[model samples]
Target: MKFTIILSILFCTSIWIPQNPDLTLDTRKDPVSLKEAAKNHFKIGVALNERQLNGMDDKALEITKQHFNAIVAENCMKSGRIQPVEGEFVWEHADRFVAFGEENNMEINGHTLIWHSQAPRWFFVDDEGNDVSKEVLIERMRTHINTVVGRYKGRVHTWDVVNETILDDGSWRQSKFYEIIGEDFVKIAFTLAHEADPDARLFYNDYSMAKPGKREGVVKMVSNLQKQGVKIDGIGMQGHVGLDHPSLEEFEKSIQAFAALGLEVLITEMDVSVLPSPSNHQGAEITDTFEYQKEINPYTEGLTKEAEQEFHDRYMDFFRLFDKYSDHITRVTFWGVTDGHSWKNNFPVRGRTDYPLLFDRSYQAKPVVKSIADFLQNP
Candidate 1:
């Protein structure tokens, strides 16, 4: 009787254990590419790094080819990376990146022509380390925009002409660009980009765009540019979000407001960070840094089942919102291709393992990929 009781107890324990369904794409009988799924709504894109473009990360390149229909260089096209010095231009990586997109027939986007961050030291300073004069700075801006945009004029379709210029409080960030050249810097940058490639679409890209103050600021700026005939094309809302901030209502408001100004709305640099933020931080300021804390980096082992579900649900909610505004939104681009490749791993607080993409570390598609594919395909 004791032996019988032991067997029954073991069986009951086994039955109570939960089973996780296989979420990888290989296991799925019907796998759909996100690009194909969202083709009718908006183009699906991903940021590509040098490794992926150079064939170093074969899995990432394969995933990029299979899933994304648009490509943007994550860092190579940035001002500092492309032109670290005054006159010298490094075109190897940027050239390779553009070629890869062209080979794939993907819509290529030049990340930025002018920005407060990642700009070369020489861009804003003189030989004696003082700020360059307004005329000198304007010339530098013109040369950089002309060279970069001119290289890929007809090949590249869109450019983030100016990035992160507006502050969250509806004021300007007062970067060296603004301080040296004043507010006309934005207009000049757009004008130079347009002159470089009249056929290419130009955009102003920024983060934390869901704030009412920021929304109003961008609308005013874009509206003013439109009125002045500055050749502006669209606004990129950098979707660097977390689990609980930038409520969908607020994000939708920005989308509506930007679209109301006759500008194409592109959801750019999107990543849903699953780790606990450092002090409720929502903006994607690359310079923002904080010391690493154990509590803030809670998911070092991996995301919990509950956390994974929450992550999945959060993405679905955002996608639903995007679908509703598909008429206004042109393209939706993820910041990175896989969780391991995500900047979230070392961002805000360095050395934290974070799962914040549709693909896991092994290049396997999470259930959310299939769910999104199914939802968009069927909807």
Candidate 2:
């Protein structure tokens, strides 16, 4: 009797100790990188500025390599920076950016082949400053797309073929591209991109994606494109959220709606701004500007514990949402790696310190990083 009792106790102990030894606690304490922790869910990515790619910021580079498995050029790959002169292309910074991604085995994303805001003045105008004919603009676009996309070809994994073409009210922005080439400019851009690199995935990226009108507009536009046999592979919903704005329900609805169209959905350019902004601020418009006020920039010294917790909670909620739809979200990319590198500081309201990234100014991962990893690992 005594021997049997001892044997039973030992068997129970061995089973518990060997098979399930405090998995939850162990995972929480484990220093798993974000990419590894979320590998099963979706790819983790970050935007890299020229400084990080040029070896000027070793600390940022190290953190990026450690935590991110995908990367996008913040500004270097944009139309203005890549080809400032019409025929003269700039390759130094862009080449370094692509090479860095390849050396690290990271999935590279080409930011934008065409955008109205950052496009060169000459692209839509003649020497007399008059808008070019539709044919002239189309040829210029073809040349630019062919030159840029053809050069990268197999290297870049995805391309944001057209950006910010639709407005918040579901109407097309009357930029030079639209005024001259009309809505077909979007079709032309996608076709040209496809011709440049058929293997590369193409995406239509935009902000204010959760708005009802914008969501419906994008759905209609993409549906029309599909009818015409456009090779669009995904829809990039720019995740530029605030602590309070962008209702989670609405965002999820947009995701489902986009996915219903049989296209992959990507949460791109994600960041949470903790600072107050003008009530009129609509979306991630780079040209929007406001005069600075001390009340708006309250956290110049540091975020108070309350504010920090709010920031943490905001991030946690978004990550939870992203995880819930992991099957539909192919990638979740932060706009910047560190709070110091984030454009939030100067966006809309200038010179306001904002803690809006997974890493702090000192290159240390915030508690939210581990919290996110823990949740994803355990959930």
Candidate 3:
């Protein structure tokens, strides 16, 4: 009688449990199994977390295989530490990422040799609070650019040498880099990157450039560069997109505009946040509390069947666009590998749960994975 009851309980549990697709990445097999299918599709990649790779039971390379052709190191290669105190340069982390890429035959996208955020304090002010003169700023910029870029000349394939320089409202956000260096700082940053490695491709990457106002600003920036004969190779659209924001029409238009500039268009930092779908009205404010605020819960409500299908559909839409212009799109990097550790959870606004990535909690490719794989195979 006891055995019969135990068996009955097991049967009940099996019937109720939804079968999750075994999407958790299998370390035993090469992770790049999907890479072959992606070849005729687009360059599929993930922004790497070195710590995650180290913590894995097996090396990522063993499972990752030839799945990616490009990789962006998250925080290791940013401005502050690389150029911690003006002229002094550090290559410890930067070198590791670049070296790993070269060894693996992957293209290394230098994630922002320059940006308005995460900069060392010294870059902005002197010991006494006086800003560094324009000349000093320019000199510091030259030294950092030349040394960093020159050191990895051939190893680093492309660079977001300048990132997020403009605001969503179409104005330059004033950072110490901008104030001390003046307007020419933009020009100088690009110029120095070009000079450092004549063969390397240079880019000015930013978010919200799809908005009409900011798009106009980006158009002007590109036009000016062309007039000056700067070797700006590509425009990286940091595709940190939300469900309703930047409608498909807006996104497609942005792509067309950048390509029209005669530059390659790379969808860098690509992630579509699933939770917090914009309210009934566009741009409606939802209180960010986990509990329902009136009619919405900002964070995800777990992976329900409907939610899984939604993820696949959204990913398919973007993948189709990428396929439509594969020739122009050089790389499409998922900002991080898994949802648990992505920066999206606490960005733009604080204390918000954000799941804006391709892989889910178990490392298993969500329905989105199969969609991408199928697209690659069919394409």
Candidate 4:
């Protein structure tokens, strides 16, 4: 009888109960604070300049620096935009980014030097306005990579050597880059990046690779790169999720699959977009009456409360998953510093309002931040 009682007590004690069973992650009740959470986690980075960084009134930047190991300058070091006229590498923003990291002793990540979207127009054409041949493109790629990557060889810790090469449908994206330079461009870029800075880690970053098809494509790409003697170091899955899209199970599978591929995974550019429109709510009610009138604030016209809550809920839930898989995820980068400057608020579907990030314009940590902090610390 005593043995039975002892066994019962032991079983009950062994049963895992989440710290807050009520699913309430109020910051007040959060004994496990952000500072505590960040201690056990990888990194936290905000994408903005001095205005936003200095805008944090409560010395949040100092507080955050105490926790996060690294910072990524969102767009300060892109291809054409950073070095617009070619050979005239404007170091204004890039210098500031590196300086901030130095000042804080933070491991800096150079966002990218090669990507399809933000390349300068001159890169696409020769002095004669004709499409540059693959040779010239490769030279330009090497030169650009050498110049930029070389500039911060030891200072910057990692580089998103390649970004968004795969499409959402798990196919190679059809861009002027791929169309002109061929698949070899990807390999050459990484090789040159490695040559420029043999010590720095290199990564291939993309979004929507959480989907099975896209995951498979990435698996193949990474495997092929490995076989070809390329120094491809990591893969970054941009976790830009909608409330209802890519269920948690699917996301977990993606994580497990990538980790199984023997590469470090970074949950780069994570944000859950809850827009100001009803359709933004996954299960929003729709009248069969073909009324375009519902499209009021076409950008953020119809965000429902339920959807907002769901968006917030998923943000927490995803972090819980992050905590569970923290062993695999090396970093979690919030795309922007605040909702006010989020790319989701406008882009792809331009003029649409988006509330995809964790902080408001004021840099106050939102519930999502608390949720993530809670999980990171407690777990």
| Most lDDT-accurate candidate | 1
List TM-score per model, in order. Answer: 0.93, 0.92, 0.83, 0.82
- In angstroms, how far off is 316's CA in candidate 4? 1.7
Q: Identify the leading candidate in terms of TM-score.
A: 1
Candidate 2's C-alpha runs over 4 A off are 1-31
For residues 1-379, what per-residue lDDT tens digits would candidate 2 score against the true structure? 2234543454334332223222224232335699999998899999999988888999899888988999998999889999998999999988998999999999999998989988888898899999899999999999999999999999999999999999988989888999999999999999999999999999999999999999999999999999999999999999888888788889989998999998989999999989886765758989899998888899989988777777877887777667667777899999998999999999988888998898889887777787778766765
Count of clashes, each model:
0, 0, 6, 9
What lDDT is reached at residue 49 by model 1?
92
**Model 4 per-residue lDDT tens digits across residues 155-208:** 999999988887655788787789898887889999999999999989998877
lDDT of each: 0.88, 0.87, 0.69, 0.70
What is residue 145's positional error in candidate 3, in angstroms? 0.9
Instruction: Name the TM-score of candidate 3.
Output: 0.83
Q: All predictions: root-mean-square deviation over Cα?
A: 10.1, 8.3, 11.0, 6.6
Over the stretch 1-379, how does candidate 1's per-residue lDDT look in tens digits?
2234543454344332224333433633445899999988899999999888777998899889999999988999999999999899999999999999999999999998998899999999999999999999999999999999999989999999999999998898889999998899999999999999999999999999999999999898888888898998899999899999889999989998998888899999998999898988779898899999998988888888888877877887788778777778999999999999999999998999998888889888888888788767754
Judging by TM-score, tell me the better candidate of 1 and 3: 1
Q: Name the runs in model 4 displaced over 4 angstroms.
A: 1-35, 50-67, 276-308
Cα RMSD of predicted structure 4: 6.6
